[model samples]
Target: MSKHNDQIAELLTDDSFVRWINGDANTLEQRKWNRWLEEDPANIAVVRQAKKLNELLWFEEEQPNTQKELKRLESALIEERTLPSEGINRGGMGMALWTKVAAAIVLLITVVGVIRYAHWGPKEPEATEQPIMATTQTGYGEVKRVTFFDGSKIILNANSKLTYPKTHQGGDMQVELQGEAYFNIAHKSGQEQRLFSVLTAEGKVAVLGTKFNVNTHSEGTEVVLEEGKVKVQKTNPKDRANKPYIMSPGELAMLFSNKSNIKIQNVDSELYTSWKNFELKFKNTPLHRIADRIEEIYGVEVEFSNKSLREIEFSGSAPNKNFEVLLEGLRTLLKIPVTYEGNTIIFGS
Candidate 1:
């Protein structure tokens, strides 16, 4: 095997390469992989097979634990490369280390194909570790609390769903969110620390330990950090030019749905975060947005009959009060006629 071939052989065991194969590599790492493939045409096939093997092992969420089989396949390939080769036809190709790797991948894929299609047809193979799936959801006018095994707590707001796996192979503690939720992540210090991430349609919020609120809607995604620090990324794949926002305490990151702009601003974090405590606090917050929050929190439809009222701003606080008291309070504050109908509140006339 040539030096380059040895490098290629060593690449299979490289963790970064494995991460790239699993779609976890950052941009620089992805570029490095691309550059490596461009340097040598043969590197393309090498990486392709490596990725195929990785995808196969991670194909299904409840896939059989095939880690041992992968290691055995790699080991067997190296051992077989030492066989007698005086007149061994390498299929008009050199007997390089890369060739052995490609051959081994093919052999392993064929054997696994037989086992998967024949033995495990229609039924998923049993595995030592089961797929971890847990979820918490809240309907309109409702709130829910979920505690993870790692002692982290999530206070989900109305019209929200949170789903998470137990933990990832690389010590990743991740969750997927739609709508709104407040996270009070437990600090997993020292060796117990895990990489925690909150993924949404807009992007993701990553932190080791922090208290944050994530609100993802059709309009945009908002991440407000109350304690500690977090990185909120605008990770829509179609828009790659947006940079990720690193938010400190009392900071908010907003990624608008229509644009690739990520804006960070210092804010009264409590106003955006106090919902979990059944408090609605505002600091000259726009009336339209506040109405949206009111509807979300109480399942009551709030609408400004006129466009002018929508642009009005309000500054006050309201506990988890019923609809009439809240409507009368707002009417007194803004001096507007508040009409309460069945399940709907209108602030016009």
Candidate 2:
């Protein structure tokens, strides 16, 4: 027999196969089924096991109502089909017969239900539930600017994900962040003012009306304040639970993951926020550090083949030029030969 026919037979007998049958099958599914049947001699054996389990569940004489029987059949089919292939013996007729019986029972039960309930009136539909909030993903080298319902704005950096409620909750305005984002929150009065919180890997940065930039990635969590103040608290603070740092403007907080240590530094807010205007400003930054920042901003990899070149420090501002121009400028300044292979920039002697 053809492998496809055998698989169909095996599937018919397997009890757990019901799940696959009832589940939605799209274009790829049909193609997969065709492919499976076309390949492998053991496909037929697997189908038989499914058929047998299905029959046992559906063919019971004392089976409940149509809906109940359908549910039972589905459950049994799933269980039987999921069984290990090693446990199935293709050489035996007992397995084949059992699968055939199960298949027959399920089919008969389904047929009877269809005949009896064909004229049954449809029931009123239940009240619709609120839809779940969908996650927004930013691809590599892509950035997105989104404005919230409350007039707050978020600028998502490359390769980031931002998930928020579909409908704003009155008690608290909260957003989950992964990667980097710059927020400009709108001022609100009364209880609404006290409810603004931005959740990140480090902790929750709570504010009423403030502007801040948060970077949460594999490297670490960084929060830079531009306007107003924000209270940075570790979501799971152990000892200093009561004391949360109130970050003011012109201050930057760095929370290192390797050690649960926090470092506060004085920063030039305008230079930090230069990316907002599509500019990369480097002030006495190491060549390696500059490469790291460029990789993060543009979602590209930079490799310095020469160890000596990696230690060199660069101090210059580069317009948000195209990748080629940026590379050429860096090469000219560092006096090193650089080549671009796909997305990776290689610096060599």
Candidate 3:
């Protein structure tokens, strides 16, 4: 092959060129792509050779183990590249040296191909090293009271998921949570000391076996302390070290996503944990926001066609009756007729 032909062959065999063929062509600019394809007719032949090699290696009856195959190929390439001494016979020695050099070139190409394939090929499934803990899920309009082996009690609200280990690990009690839950953790007395933690999407709450309630959804996360004290820290730290804020009883830790800021204030603990009793309490909460919470608790869809009603603020408690009855009460309070259609509730004229 000519020098230009050799260069074309090398480019065609490149892993990047293979990636372009394997569905990454969009990454190349239009002009560069056109120039590459128009380089030479021999380039097409080189591409075909690469494609054939790829098919032969990947489509065989049973593909070999990638690591083992690469290791064997490397050993063979090393043996093929070992040249004889200069003192050897000139005739056969020259032929042997050329053979070794040619073999070395081929081996180099194969090694490059192997490395690229190992990186871009179908990955092997990795075995899970740790066993998952027991998980509990609460459906819509449902609530569950769970008692852990360590004597901690958790009340999971509607559409909530809680996962905890079957057996308590020494030193700490940890539980992963999604949605809303009220926890009444029992204290453990020992020289080693015991810690309790609740893990959520926003962060993790660590306590010395205290009572707390955690409410988390797409909007944000809220931590309320009913008894004892707790420390809140971001699970995935943005800075090099995490900053934890401690909250005493009757305090609330509100984490908002817009500014990624945490606000701590004294709050009425009953307002936070009232959902456990099926009572909805709102303190200056927007009508639309209340509707959203009602929908989540009842597994229904709420639509406020009258956009004006969304700006209204509601403050009071509603009974834990069925959704229809609750809507009837709201209708009386707001002086607007609420209509229910299947699973959708609409607020309109």
Best by lDDT: 1
Predicted candidate 2 versus true structure: per-residue lDDT over 1-349, tens digit per residue: 4766665665665444544454545667656755775697665555455555555566546755899767877875774455332211211223344333433332333222111111112322431233244344443444567787778888876546666757654435567677777889887897565456777666677788889988886656788999998877665467453357889898988765554556789887765666655566777677798878777755568998978877777766665534555666777766678777766778775
Per-residue lDDT tens digits of candidate 3, residues 1-349? 5775666567666777667656566556445655776897766766676666655666437766999868877886666445333211112213344334433433443312211111112333542123246666554555678887667789887666677766544545567777789999888787646677887766778877888999887756799999988888765476545578899999999765443557889998987888877677878778898788876665668888888989788778876544545676777766677888866788867
lDDT, each prediction: 0.70, 0.63, 0.68
Residue pairs with colliding backbones in model 1 are none
lDDT of 3: 0.68
In the range 67-98, model 1's lDDT, one tens digit per residue, is: 97778767766755663332222121122443
lDDT of 2 at 129: 30
In Å, residue 193's CA in model 1 sits off its true spot by: 0.9
- What TM-score fits each model? 0.58, 0.58, 0.59
Assess candidate 2 and give its TM-score to the true structure. Answer: 0.58
RMSD of 2: 20.9
Residue 251 of model 2 has an lDDT of 92
